[model samples]
Every structure is written in C-alpha cells, then in structure tokens.
Target chain A: MDSHSHPAPTADVATVAARWSKKAVVVAGVGAVLAVVGGLSAAKDGGFGKQFGFSYLQAFMFFLSLCLGGLFLTVVHHLFDAAWSVPVRRLNEHLACLAPVMFVLFIPILILAKQIYPWMQIADPASDAALHAKSPLFTPGGWYGVSILLFVLWTFVSFQLRRNSLNQDKDGAAIHTQNMRVHAAYGIFIFALGLTFAAILWMKGLEHQWFSTMYGVYYFAGSVWTTLATLYVISLALKKAGPLALVMQRNQFHDIAKLFYAFTVFYAYIHFSQYFIIWNGGMPEETFYYVQREQGSWWGIGMLIVFGHFLIPFLAFARIDAKLNIAVAIPVCVWAWMMHYCDMSFNVMPILRPKGFELTITDLGCWLFIGGVVAIAWLRSLASHPVYPLKDPRLGEALGIHFHDEGDAGHAPAKASK
Target chain B: MADSNIDYTVKLGLLAEYATPAELMQAAEKFREAGYRRWDVYSPFPIHGMDDAMGLGNSKVGWFTFCCGASGYTLGMIMIWWMNAHDYAIGVGGKPLFSPIFSFPVAYECTILLGAFGSLGGMFILNKLPRHYNPLFKVERFSRATHDGFFLFVETSDPKYSDIETRKLLESTGTRQIEEVRD
Candidate 1:
C-alpha cells in the first residue's frame, strides 16, 4: 500500500506570497486614489459629505459581517471534522484574521452613529415614546457594547485556534489535535452568540423600529453567500497564480461551487419570504421597508438580483457539467459577488433615503475603500503562511480522491482490491 | 492440488454470485439473519436497504445534518438582530428592532442552507466519497458489478468464514460461480 504522503515545496509558497503581495499593492493604490477623489467631490456638496460618511459606515459594517461569517464557517467545519474543505479551509481561516482589522475599521461607524442613526438624534423622552410606541426593545448602548464584545471575542478565539493549528505543523504533536477539538467545541458556541449579536448590530438595527425575528437568519444567509463567493474567487485566483495549483483540484472547486449555489438559493428564499410575509400581513411599519426596496432605483436593483442572483445562477449550476466547469463556474461566482454587494447596498441605502436617493461617487468609493482594506488584510495573512495547510492530516486523503467520473453517470462505484 | 475438476478449480472461497437482483437481495437477508457482520452486497444499481439487510446501523449523517440546520437557523436570527437592533439602531417606518415577521426569511433560508450543507458534507464523511483508491477496486471482476452484475462476498475476515465450510455453505445457497478475494 502507498503511504499517500506528499509535501508542498517551499518555492511554491514563496511564489504565492509574492504574487498576492503584488496584487494587494495594486488594489490598495487604486482604492486610495478613488477615496481621495470621492472625498473631495463630497466636500464640494455639504449634504453629500454627510451621506459619504454614512455610506462609509454602511460599507464598513458590511465588510465586518463578511469577516464574522467566515469565522462562523471555519468553526463549524472544525466541529464537524469536515474533510472536503481541507483544501480551502486555510483561506477561510485567514479571512477570519481580518476580524481585528474590521474592529479598527468599525471605529468610523461608531464615531458617526449619531449622524447616521435617527435614534441618536431623539432625546431620552422622545426615544422613550418611540420605544414605547415601537416595542420596549430599544437599547442602543447595550446593543453597541455587546457587538464590540462579540467582535473582540470572535477575533481572539479564531486567531488563537488558527495559530495553534499552524504551530501543530512544526511540532507534529498529538496534543494539537486534542487542543483543536476542545477549541472547536467552545468555538461553535461563541460563533452562535457572536453571529447573532453581529446581525442585530448591522442589519436589523438599520431600521430601529422595524423588527424582524428572521433578520439574523437573513443576514446570515447573505453572509454565507458572500463569504462563499469570496472564497471561490480567491481560490480561483490562487490557482491561476500557480502556488496552490497542485493542492486545489477540480474536485475542490466543485465542492466550493456547490456551496455557492446552495447559499445563493438560500439567500433568495429568505429575501422573498420576508417580503411575502410582510406584504401578506399588511402592517404599515413592517411592510414599508419592502415598499422602499421595491420602488424607484432600489426596485431595479432588486429585480436584477431576482433574476441575476437566483434565476440565472440556478439554471447555470443545475447541471453537473456547469458546476465542475471553470469556464461556467467563474462567471457565476463573479455574479454572486455582484449580487451580494447589490443586496447589501439595497439594505443600507433605503434606510437613509426615505424619499429615495441616487447613487453617488461616495457609494462607490465606500465599497472600494473597505474592499481595498479587506483585500490587503487577506493578502497579509496569506503571505504569513503557505497557501495550503502543509501538515494537515487530511491533505493526502484529499489529494488521492477523485469525486467525479468522465461519463454522465456521475459518481462511480468503489472497486474492491484483488 | 490434484486434478479433481473441482479441486484444481481454485476454491474461490465462499464467493456467491447471483444471476438476478432478487437472489442477491435474498442472500443478503439470509446473511443478515445469520448474524453475519463482515459482508457486502454488490449490484448493477443501488439496492435499497442493502446496508440494513446486512444489519448495518443507521448512518450518522442525520445527526450532523440536524446540528447544521439548527445552527444555521440560530445564526440567521442573530445576524438580523445584530444588524437592526445593535449596530445602527435606525428606525425604518417605526417597526420594532426585533420583529419576528421580518426576520423569518433569513432564519428559514439559514435552515435550508445549513441542512443542504449538512447533507452533502455528511454524505461525504459517512460514505467516504471521492476516494479514488480502495482495496476493493483491485478485484478485476468487481469493476463490472457496478456496470451490470450482482454479487455478495463474505470476507475471510468474518468469524464464521472458513475455506471448506464456507465454500460448502455457499454451494448450498445455489451459487454457480465463486471467486476468491485476497487482501
């Protein structure tokens, strides 16, 4: 029997690190130039400056949500002892490292909360009226503090676990496995709590008075959808760059593609269900959110997502050929990323523009700035280690398996050795 | 070793080949009833409950899927709360921050998303899919079983298996051809 062992060459790691660093520098430079241009333009229009700041806050929160979601996926994979994700788990873990960066990035939102959130402008008595009339559930300070604590805790735990796993590679100790299992068990609990608080602070609070029990799940669906799409793009880029060329195969890509499809559908279902239920109930306050989203420019974006996010991708990925074919999968992955941005934009813009609003230089700038920072953080993490988990026990198992057969019968049956 | 047409025939050793799907299923049931543990059934198409007929326990996949679905729901709810209630606290149309009606879509989506993930991930883990190489694949004739044949093999590792006795037992069961499986 073959030992099924293989090592990732050091030259491969260096090449990957160098390529990612170059890409990071280029993206950062472009984003910096755009931010200055957008800031100057906003300065020319006084009211637009305020909108720029608010949009920046919205973008920051969206990025933070993506990091938190990545953390949740990593911990869940650990808890389940998942093998299929072995090829890409490192990328997800590295993305989680951005949580600390997000913590700092979120400061902009915290400073300008009053300007963006209406609840900040109303005094205690007026707030009390709003709260009383609304549902005595308003607690801005408590909500803020809990969100900070959750981000801190998740960042701390995820970094520690990932660090330990990488260290295990050098030490080759059985104790690392034991430690990981323990971390995984507790990590899942924190993930649940942290993600819940994250959704409340980010999306649900967009409309302080408008409450949705399903808001967290809705945000979660978007999070997973975006994160999975992001992972697919990153993995594809890495493969093209040639460092992870050997480790990632068509089978791994197939797995990631499947996840992207599943979550895309999941996100659409939640989006529609929220609308359907609110429209059916006919409540003025709850239904108004949808009314804003379904009309004007926002309406057009929603329609785009309906067909672009769900319908288009659903048809494209329905067949086994498309899911496994990079030619087809890459475009769908890019579309998923675009739809995620549109979805987040639709959620954020409608809250600020009661009378409806137009897209500004700031909206695009905010996305670029935060996206630039996220790209930088991800690159820095990737540079710090090999693109693949060089010492993971399952690396060999993943390499040896072939998930699909050449013909239309799909998965082939296992053969018995003579 | 001598030329008794059956002796030199190479005791394929307890290998039982079935001409029809029903016969294969019946042999599986009998082996299961006889308390045989280390045996497997092969067919041209998936034989439903062959695992159970062989007395295998229910798969652990359900537990994994349930956990994933439950967590997905919980995660969805929390995400909505964090975004709407905690972070910005903006009031859109005077709706409460924790409205169940609004949050249901996200929660439901998470459940389905996680459930599907659990099913796919669980199937891979339980059945050990994507395995390109297995000891069983070394059997030349075994390759055709997946194409258009039915077979049942009681591994020599089984406690009840013996060269002579097992062969006689398989002969009694009306197998026309038998083949030895070596590890």
Candidate 2:
C-alpha cells in the first residue's frame, strides 16, 4: 500500500480566509444597512415591512437549504462509510455547524411570522376551511413550537455529528466513527422530518391553503442540488489554494460533479411530480397555488427554472469529462446559485408581489446580508480547525492508495522484483 | 479431448504471463506507450486504473443510450397523441387530448426501457460479442485467467507487432514466460 503524506499546516488557507473575512464583514454591514433602509421606507404603509418579511423569508430559506444540505451530506457520509468524500467531510461539518447560526437567524422570521404568514392573522380558524383542517399545526403556538423544535433537533444532530468528527481528528479512534454512526442512525430521520416540517412551516405556510404531499421532498431535492454545486466550487478552491491539494484527487471532483448531475434530474423529477399530481387532481384548493404562479412574470420564472435549473445543468454536465473541467463546472455552479435564488423567489415572492418576479432592495439586501453572515461564520469555523480530517482511517483510501494484506507477503514486491 | 479435433496452422499472437496484477499493469503501460493497438491484458479480477494504463479513454456506449432514450420518449409522446387525439378523438375527463403533462409518465418509462436496451445492445456491439473462437482457447496456461493468472496478449495483426521487438518489450517488463499462440 502507498502511504500519503500528512496534510501541511493550514496557515496559507488561514491567511487567505482572514482577508475574505474582512470583506465579508463589510458586505454584511452594507446588506444590513440597505435592508434596514428598505424596511423603514416600506413601513410608512407597511408595504416594505411585508416586503421585508417575505424577502427575508426567501433569503432565509435559501441559506437554510445550504445548512440542511450540509447536515444531510455529513449524515450520509457516515451512514454509507464513504471514502471518496472523506477529504471534503470537514467542510461539510463546518457548514452543518451553521445550524445554530440559522436558529439565531430564525428570530427575524419569528417576529415577522404574522406579517409574512396570513393564516396567523385570521380571527377564527373555523372561518377558513383549509386553516381549520390543519388545526393545531396551523395555530401560532404549534407553528412557533414546531419551528423551535426543528432548530433544536437540527442543531443537536449537526453538533453531534461534528463533535464526533472533530474528536476523530484528535485521537483517530474507531470509537469516534462508531459514535457518529449512532448519531447518523437517528440523524437521517431527524433530517427528513425536520427539513419537511421547516419547509412546510416557513415557505409553504405563506400559502396556508396549498396542499402537496410532495412539497417537503420538492424543497429537499432543490436544496441538496444547490448545496452540491456550492460544495464543488468550495472543494475545488481549497484544492487549488493548497490546503486540500495532497488529499484531493481528480476522482473527488468527478464524483461530486456526478452526484450534482444526478440531483439535477432528481430536483426536476420532484418538482415535476408535484406539479403533475396537482394538475391531474384538478382540485381548486391545490390548483390555486400553480394558477397564481402561472400568472404574469411568475410564469416566465417557472419556465426559467425548468430550462435554467434543470435542462441546462442537466445537459452541460452530462458528459463525463465536462464534470472535471473547471471551465464548465465553475459556470454551472454560478448558474446553479442563480437558479436556486429564482426558485426561492418563485416560491416566496408570489405572495408579496403576485404580479411578477421583482428584485427589490430588501430582497438583494437580505440575500447579501444572510449569505455574508453564513460565509463569515463558515470561514471562521474552517480557519480554526484542520482543513480536512487529519487522522481519518479512510483518508488513505480517498487518496487512491491500495493496501495489500499480510496474506500477500509471499508475493514479490513488484518494484523490488523488477 | 474436445480440443484435439482441431489443427493449428495460422499464428494468432504473442502472450506473456505476469505473476501479479501490478506487473500486468506495468506491462500494459509499456505496450500502450509502445503504440500497440491490438493488445489486451487479462486478470482474474478487474484491476483499477488498468484502462488508463492501456491508454483507453471514455467509452462511447453513452451515445447509444442517449439517442435511444430520446427517441423512445419522442415515440411514446407521439404514440399517445396519435392514439388519443389524432386517430380516435376520445374525450376523457375533459383534459387536453395530448398535453405532455398527462403523457409524461408513460414517456419517461419508455425512456428508461429503451435506454436499458440501448445499454445492452451498445455493450454487445462495441465488444463484438457472441464471438465463438479464439486461439487463446487452445493455450492451456491461459485457462488460469479465470483464477490466479495475469496475462497479456498482443495480436499479430497489430501494426506495431514484431516477434523479436514485442518479445523484448514483454521481457523488459519482467514477465517470466512468453509464448506464441497459434490457430
């Protein structure tokens, strides 16, 4: 077996990150100020407050996708005992760690819940059929209770996974691996249920009357799809930037791209099914959601999603070689971010600016502010630790090393015999 | 006993035996660099990186799958449209006679079905499969290819093949045995 050398110290990555952190702080400040200005102006008639509420909710959901995507990736890595992703696992852990930050971020939405969610304002639940049927969950107490519980469950699972992982970096013990498996065993359930519930409460709740059993998975598929693109760009940067050069291999990028390709189809599959089922069922209650989205520019945005989100990436990365080409991959990654923002806007903006898709200062501010905060938090977490798990048992496997066992001692070592 | 019925007249190729997969891989790289086109390596089990060692690139089987799958979807949509709207004009539930929405489930399944057929057919075609004869079948030692043996065979038809030169190249890779196969 070939032994890979230990990764060098992360001083170089840390230096670059320090510069980025400063820039991120500036961006975050600018975004916050802009969002505040937009909010105050709109508050004259509560137009901007409602706008601010919906815009922030959209941006919040977008970032939440990344955090949940991170947790999902980390949980599965342990569950499958995957080797190829071992190099990128620490990045995933730090991303998942942002769940607590997301909980803090959720405070704004909690305050604006009434402004954002109309169902909360209805005097009597009995007056509204859809609202009444959904009863306890539709109630403000149930909404806030379940919302807090989701964050708690997510933060717990994300921290447990990361704690075991970081401890493994210290001791390289099999026990850490075992402990993670125990967490992941239950973590998968938490992830599925928690993500579904959050999507229902926060985004889907905007239209409390809407009904789609596939809504949770629809959000999940898109979230992970965007997350994979983000991971690809980050891992590639780290590889070129020197922290992950030794451990990262060609196959890692290829595999990541391949998974991204699969999710492109998967996201399309899920969203299409959601639409197809409702369209076929032809129920006015459910069909109203699509009917509203089909009006005006929301129609164009929907078309953009079908082509830009699914078709373009699906075709662009279809070739095996294209997945490894940084030229092709970087552009697709950027496009994926744009597409996901559009998707989030399509879901959230339809309620506030039902005429069409409008890009407001609040929208941009909320996006930039939340994105910068997450980036700063993620960079701080990344710089503080070893860029990759230093002592992972499967690190060698990820580096493409093949070890022959003691049973093969009788065979002549190839190079020596040659 | 069955093999005794045939006569060996034509020379088929040159074969070299390696003790292990690592040696086979090394020899494969040498042959690849030597620019021999009609050669292959055989081992008891699949070897990773062997394709690159032998200078092979991505397979072309994907084209077959894509084209066939696309056609299957197109054909499926057309089949539904012709049967329901163009031919009979039956009204069911007052839905559009041929919206891609209603036809999609069937079309998607057709894409998968024909895509699988394309994969199987492409593999068989590219491999030139259902082949009934090979001179290597008569080489007793080559039978170990299914067990512990690792072998390399360079066909005489290769543009680069030369009895002396090929033998010297195989020898340089540290193969212990080399034999000339005959048909």
Candidate 3:
C-alpha cells in the first residue's frame, strides 16, 4: 500500500488525555499558590512590592509575546505549506492558546497601571511638568481596553482555527483546510493590528513620552524569536515522551533550529537599527531610553544578549552538521530562553531603575510565576488532542514514507527513522 | 557496447516489480553495496539519506551563497560611501560620512537578497532547470516516477555496462521491472 493511503496507527486517546490533564491540574495548582504568595509578599514589603509590580508586568508582556509568536508561526507555516513543521505545529497551536490566559494575567497590570506606568498618574496637576508634557500623547484607559480587546479577538480567532484543524483530523474533512486558509488570512490582519496596540500598551506606554515607529517591529522580532525557542523546547520534550517520537526526526529539528537562528539575526537587526537611529538622532527624549539601558548594570545584560542571542548561537549553529546534532541544539534552545528573559528585562527594568541595579528575588519570582501559569495553560490544551495530527495529509510525507519508495530495499531508510 | 545497446532497446530481461517501500529501499542499498554508480532512483518525494545511498556529493549552493553575499556586502559599502560621502555630501544629522552602523541595515538587506538570488541561480545551473523536455520523459513507465514508482536506471552508456551483465546485476540487487532507454 502507498504511504498516503495507509491507515493511521491506533492510539489510546483517553490515556494521553488523562496524563496531560493530570499534569495541567498540578501545574495550575502550583502557579496559583505562587502567584498568591508572590502577590502577598509584594504587598507586605513596599519597596519589594514596587519591584514585584514591575516584574509582574514584564512577565505578562513576555508571555504575551510568546503566544503572539506562536500565532505568527502557525500563520507562516500554513502560508508556505511547510511540511517539516507538521510534527511540531500542534504544539505551537496549543501554545497560541495561551493568549486568553495572558489576557487574564494582564489584570494585574491594570490594577498597578498607576504605579507601573507614569502616564496613568498624569492626571495629578502637581505631577512633574515633564510627565504632564507627555500626557497628551499617552492615554492609559484607551490603551488598556484596546490591548485587552485585541488579545481577546486574537485568542478567539486562533482557537477557532485550531479547533477546526483538530476536528478535520478526526473526520478527514478537506474543507477544513480551505476554512483554515481563509481564517488565517483574516487572522494575519488582526494579528498585525493587535501586535501594534500591544507594543504601544506594554512597552511604549512604559515611558509614555517616548515614541519609536520601529518599536512595533522590534517587539515582533523578539516575539518570533522566543516563540521559535519555546516550540523547539516543547518539541524536544514531546519527542522524549515517546508518543510523537515517530513523527519527530533530526531533519525536523534541524529545520526548527535554522528558523530560530534566522530570527535571532532578524531580532539583532531590528535592535541595532533602533539603537543606532536613536543615538545618531540625538533627541534627548529618544536618547534617554538608550542612555539608561546602555550604561549601569543593565549594559552587561544587553551585551550578553547581543552575543548570546545572535553571535554565539549564530557561530555555534552555522554548520548543517551542528544543526542536526541534538546535543548542540538543546543548549542553543536553553540559551534562547535565557536571552529572551534578559531582553524583556532590558525593555522593562530601565523604566523602574534608570540607573540599573543588581538582579533581585522579585524578578526571579515573577518569571517563575508567569512561567508556571503559561506551562499549565499550554499543557491543558495539549490534553485535548493528539500530540501529532495523526490524520494530517502531510504527516506521511513528513515521515518520508510516501508511495514512490514502496517495495524498495530502502523502505525503512536509516535517515528516515532519524 | 553498440551491440549491447541494441539488445537493451529490443527488450528488458528478468523484469520484476516491487510492491513495498521497504523492498525498493533494500534494493537501493544492495546496489550501493555492490558499488554501482551509474544508476538513478526516481521518487515521488525527497527521501532522507537517499542521496548517500545514491552516492551523491554535498550540494554546491553554499559556495554560491558565500560568493554572492561577499559581493553584496562590498556593493552596499561602495554604494553608500559614494552616495553620502562623495556625491551629495549633505549631512543632515551630523553623522559621519562612513558610518558602518548606518550602512549595516542596507548591507544586511543586500546580503539576504544576493544570497537568495545566488541560491536560486545556482539551483537553476546545477539542476539544468527550465528545460521544456528531457529524454527520460520518453519512457512510458517513467511518468509513474512522479507519482508512485521508484526506479533505478543503469544507463547503457556507463563504461561497466553490458546488456547481459547489467541485467544480472540489477536482478541480483532485487530491482524489479528494470527498463532500457533509447537515445
């Protein structure tokens, strides 16, 4: 029988679902406790609480970027008809589900908007003249509602498409493909709008007077970078679980790694462009952002990302042979995750401590809390479906077991299995 | 050699068909082990490691990318230098004439553009693409190659080829339904 015509392997859906559900409940419980404890601790210690508020806002922004990145990946994969991503595409889709969870997480930002954002307090006539001068350009209520609405719309659309895809797999419906394509096209438009408002709300609004057109693209580049990294780590974990093992292979891993590498370069380009432009322009307002970031304790973190995010990883994964090696790939993935956290800190912390101080426990706690919440939400989504789309038309082709090689001695090619 | 060519054209001998992917791959490996070099396998999709099985070398696209990327970088530097430093000399932002930082974005774009073009051109030159026709398409059964068939062609032009000997080698390697081409 030809590869495409072969029946899918039978698997116990109930068993997979139960395992993931249990894991999700455990993670959610832990995240809830941590968030409560972290929140209470911040309130008790006024100095530390202020830092906690900022870190909590940063974590929300980071997770927001991660989910948005997944959304972009899903769109790009469908646009290009990429077959290699089929194995990991489900994981990315599930991660995209975190957008709603992040929307809820953003509640803390709204509560602390006055403390975290200078724009929110501009109504006080006694506030600093410089802050009042920037108030005309900044509107907190408008930004908050817009940001939340955009997230809701993006989540609703993404979930719809993801649902259709899963349903298509079970019933072998071809129309769903067409439905998804149409949805994705519209989804891309919403994504662009949502992403712009998100950048304005989360990052730009931090310093309300500060403005940069490149900020939107900068945020996007970072989002995609972290998303690709998250997808790689999750795919590796899934392969280790042994259910989707047959679908995952070295070639697939290599492709994802290449994408990660490409986006790191893209991120660096956007970052340098923003920095050089502002420095050359010499606008005091514009230069203030960089001056704060380029000096003090944060400068080292910035330099580390410049190298760790792009240079080090670029050199390490330049060769095809290295991209194919899991041992090498794993470190690059881990480093990417670290670089993302550093990048987020660079974007947020400057507003809080313009002079740049040492790392604090609040920063670490907030990241852990956000990480736990995101992990739990993502695991819950995975519990609802097969890890790999078993009935996907491209799965066989992705597995490299198509019709042409039938009856050949190379049927189970060594490389194919890898 | 001329006599063998005539024999091959007249009829294919010891023809048998494979019904499974595993069998076809096994036959391919057998051919590899037997040190056969003048054969080609046609598949509906790209199979991993099939190149090694067929003894193909690494692709030359990388060399193309490197050369084109270097040229692109050089061109970007020269273009910006001529436009800003030499031609107009209009300084708006008090920036230096030869700003590597300013030139970086343009240089990066050029690198990607040239690299992409180089890969495309190299692929075209290497694969001899855009040809309207090929002699291989003349074979009736070969059409299935783009669909469901995996085929190995032991060309008559190869130095080691003889009608009788090649047929024996193919049969021994478990290649089913071997065919001959007339050029």
Best by lDDT: 2
lDDT of 1 by residue, A1-418 (tens): 0123445444665667667667767766776576557767766554544566667866776676678667867777778777667778778888887888888777767776666666656677353554555433346676567768877888888887788778766755657656766887898778776776676666666677676777777877878877887787778878778766666766677777788788878888887777777765788878777887877678888788788878898778866557867788788877877777777777777876655545566766677778877877887777767676666666545553322222211111111000
> What digit string (tens of lDDT, one per residue) describes model 3 on residues B1-183?
567655434332223235444555566676666776666667777766666555566688877887898788889888888998899786866778778778877987898899889989988988888898866777788787788877776665566667777778778766557666654
Off by over 4 Å in 2: A1-4, A405-418, B1-8
Q: Could you arrange the candidates by TM-score from highest to lowest?
A: 2, 3, 1
Whole-model alpha-carbon lDDT for candidate 3: 0.73
How accurate locally is residue B1 in candidate 3, as Cα lDDT from 0 to 100? 57
Per-residue alpha-carbon lDDT of candidate 3 for residues A306-411, written as tens digits (9 for 90 to 100):
8887888877887777776778878887888778888888888888777774455566566666776787677667766777666666665666554453243324
- What fraction of the real A-B contacts shows up in model 3? 0.36
- Show how many residue pairs clash in every candidate, following the order shown: 58, 0, 23
Off by over 4 Å in 1: A1-5, A43-49, A125-140, A354-357, A401-418, B1-183
lDDT for A392 in candidate 3 is: 64
Q: List the residue pairs that clash in candidate 2.
A: none
Which candidate number would show the highest TM-score if scored against the true structure?
Answer: 2
What TM-score does the A-chain of candidate 3 achieve? 0.88
Question: lDDT tens string, model 2, A7-103?
Answer: 4457877976787799899888998988888777777655665878988999999999999999999999999999989989999988898999998
After TM-score superposition, the amount by which residue A130's alpha carbon in candidate 2 deviates from its true location, in angstroms, is: 1.5
Tens digits of per-residue lDDT, candidate 2, B12-62, equal 799999898878877888898889999999999987667767878899999
